[model samples]
Every structure is written in structure tokens, then in C-alpha cells.
Target: MTKDSSPTQLTHFDQQGQAHMVDVAAKQDTHRTAIACGVIRMKAETLAIITEGTAKKGDVLGIARIAAIMAAKRTSDLIPLCHPLALTRVHVDFSITTETNTIQCQAQVETVGKTGVEMEALTAVQVGLLTIYDMCKAVDRGMVMSDIRVLEKHGGKSGDWVSLIDQQDHN
Candidate 1:
């Protein structure tokens, strides 16, 4: 294995590299929730078009919300490592901050499962943000996607972690 390989490579996969999914069956089924976020950066004018619901592609937030929810529910199908989970609930919130001229998409995924919901949450946000970029590309071809990350995670063996990005604002 290369020195730059991820720690996950050392822990999860075997030497045969058959790509087996991790078994969380022995782990306790705890209520888990993960909040993931991503940003869609575009021209100020393009944002105004989204804000005004004037985009020819239709309701930006509405489509993004549905996309995120659907992505969360289908996480197992999209990623091989993720376990199929009966998610208790999924919530996606969209906010546009004029200060940064960016659209922030946040996905909160909740479930009572042996494995965590971080991947589901992250996937939802990524797809949702990408959908936005696709929809608005005609107006802003240079749209940039950035800062796709988990903002918070809870109810797992590792306990909880809140992103330093969130903590920095509080201090």
C-alpha cells in the first residue's frame, strides 16, 4: 500500500481486495443524525434569478430539496460501502447568503441503524448542490462547487463532531 493511502484502506478492505462491505451487524442500533453541507458559487445576478424564481429551469430550491431526499434514500445504491438503511427522516434546507454570493445546501439525515448516516447526508448534499449547478449553468457557466463536507455527526461509536467551520463563528 502507498504511504499516502487513506487510513480506511488499512482498516476496512482485505489484502485480496475483493471490496467487501463492512459488517455493522454487531454494532448497536442507535439513533443517528448527520448534517452535511455544500456550496454553489455563482454570479450575483444568477443568484438573484434563483431567488426570484425566474430561472427558466423552474424552482431551484424545490428541485434541490427533492433531489437531496431521494439521494439520501438511495445512498446504498449509489455507494458500495454504505449499508442499506431504513432512514427515519431526511431534511434538506437551502439558504442563499448574499454576503458570499453563494447558495448553501444542507442535508440532515436521521436513522436508527448500526452504521452511521454520514455518507447518506454527504451524498444528498453533493447531488443536491450539483443539481443546482446544472440547472443554473446556462446563466452562470462558471459556477463553482466547493466546501462539500459533513458539518456535524452524532450517535455513533465515535460520538459527535461539529465542524470547525461552525465553531469558528461562535468564538
Candidate 2:
């Protein structure tokens, strides 16, 4: 964004309000990374079943990890006006919070490209959490997936940005 640009400006739209993909042909390819997070809050028993590997669907985290990686690669197909990035790395991790009865999903995506991978990271986290929900829905359909957002992004023309919540989490 420039000095005259508003933060609310939708970059995906043209002046005529027609949707289009942002052109990155002029932008230099740089090593970029993004991290996104989401949490799926479920019943305690549901969490226990997943953590104890007793779910009928087999390994929850393993399946979710694979699903997240595939989602990252397919983000361009699912979302409009997104560049198909050649991501070099995609890592999906999960943490089970027994006390909170939640499963936290995080996806860190790295790519050497002209555009940012924030959308890819976000998509990965969401799909990963959704996979968990899908595999465990038989046990807990009421599971709530929330707080899905990009926690941080690095290596862009505008430099790096980190969410305040993520900064507070580090402290």
C-alpha cells in the first residue's frame, strides 16, 4: 500500500469493480513465509478419543497434515484472484489442549515467489482443522473452528508484519 492507499482497499478488484488477480510479473521473487493458525474446540471426550488414537478414522493429525499440505498447493483453485505459487515448504502442526478441549492447527508455508503466501497458509490451517473436524465429526459434530487468521508474514516488498495477538503470545 502507498501513502494514498486506504487499508480497506480491496486489491483484488479493478477500478471498475471487476475481480482480477494481482499482477506480480514486475515484482521480484523473494523467499516468503507465512504462518496461520486456527483452533477447533470440541468436547473433552472427543479430544481424548483423538489424542488416544482411538478414533475410527485412524490417525487424525497425520491425515490433517497431509490435507493441509494439499490444500496449500490447491489454494489457487479454490480461491478467486489468487496466484498459483510454487511453495517450497508447507508444514502443518497440531497441538491438543486438553484443558481447553481444543485442537490448535498451525501451518507455516514458505515460497520463493513474487507474491505472499498468506492466503495459502490460512487455507492450509483451515483445511487442516476442517479435516480434523471431518474425521471426528462422527464423535463431535458441534466442534467449533475459530480464530482462523494469518499470525505472521515475512519476506515481502513491504517487509514483515506480525499480528498483535501473536506478539502477545510470544511474551
Candidate 3:
């Protein structure tokens, strides 16, 4: 297989075009932070059960919050190419939107390491939503998760980036 030597080439591929983890050994250690967000929509009754803490599973959001933080720390284990990072902080937040019968999850992950924590943040958001689904599935199996994305990332050689959708919302 031929390799793309272009600067824009995918980092996970080597000169022989084989998939491998990027070598960050030469990279400088910087304080990196990433934020990710997603939303899960469910039936109004299910949302009510979650908000009112009436679910049979017990304290849905509280459990999911813990699950998200754990997911962030374990992200490298789940994704093959990801580096195991020593995270300095992981913060997860959930907001209920009664108008849309949805719950939004956001995660902020930080690490003083060579690579950014984008994957950790994204993983945390996804796992948080999954935990919510698992706890409430009996009442709302049709719950849908959507809009999982990295909202912003700071640090690294390439510098900072913010999703266009996120920028528009703030504007």
C-alpha cells in the first residue's frame, strides 16, 4: 500500500500505509482540553421519570455522570489507536430539555500530555448517553441519541479548533 506523505495525511497510518498509533514521543507535553456534547431524546414519560428520580434503576443522571467520567479515563482502552492519557480533569454535565423531551450531555476532558483529549471527551458524552438509555430503556426503548461531536479542542501542535455548529450557537 502506498502512503500519503502529505501533511494532511491521517496520523494513524504509517509510511507503509499500515494502521498504527501515532508516535507522540517527540511531541511536547502541553495542557490539552476538549469538550464534547450529545443529546438523547426519549418519551415525555421517560424524561419525567428521570427528572423526578422515579426510575426503577435509581438516580439515572447520577449514575450516568459517574459512567461518563469512567468512560473518559478508559477511552484509550476502548479505541485502538488512542493513547492512554493521564487525565487531569474530567467533568460531565447533563441538562434536561422538557420542551423537546431530550437530555443533553456534555463532557470536558483535560490532560497534560502530548496528545489532545478529544477522544476522551467524545467517549464520555457517548457513554453517558448510553447509560441513560440503559437505565430508562424499559420505559422508552425508542429513545434516540444524536449530535455526538467534539465541540472544541485546545492545545497540541495544530492549535485550537471549535466546531462550526458550536460557534454559530454562540454567535
Say which candidate scores most in TM-score: 3
Question: Cα miss at 49, model 2 (Å)?
Answer: 0.8
For candidate 3, the lDDT comes to: 0.94
Each prediction's TM-score versus the true structure = 0.89, 0.94, 0.95
lDDT accuracy of residue 164 in candidate 2: 97
**Local lDDT at 80 for model 3:** 97
TM-score between model 3 and native: 0.95
lDDT of candidate 1 over 1-171, digit per residue (tens): 332456366545656766667767667889999999999988999999999999999999899899999999999999977789999999999999998889999999999989889999999999999889889988899989999999999996778889998889789
Q: Mark the regions of model 3 whose C-alpha exceeds 4 Å error after superposition.
A: 1-7
Mind giving the per-residue lDDT tens digits that candidate 2 earns over 1-171?
A: 223446589877778888887777878999999999999999999999998999998999999999999999999999988899899999999998899999899999999989999999999999999999999999799999999999999996877999998789889
Return the lDDT, model 1, position 11.
40
TM-score of 1: 0.89
For model 3, residues 1-171, the per-residue Cα lDDT tens digits are: 123245566878776888998878878999999999999999999999999889999999999999999999999999999999999999999999999999999999999999999999999999999999999999999999999999999997778998998789889
Whole-model Cα lDDT of every candidate shown, in order: 0.88, 0.92, 0.94
* Candidate with better TM-score, 1 vs 2: 2
- Candidate with the larger lDDT of 2 and 3: 3
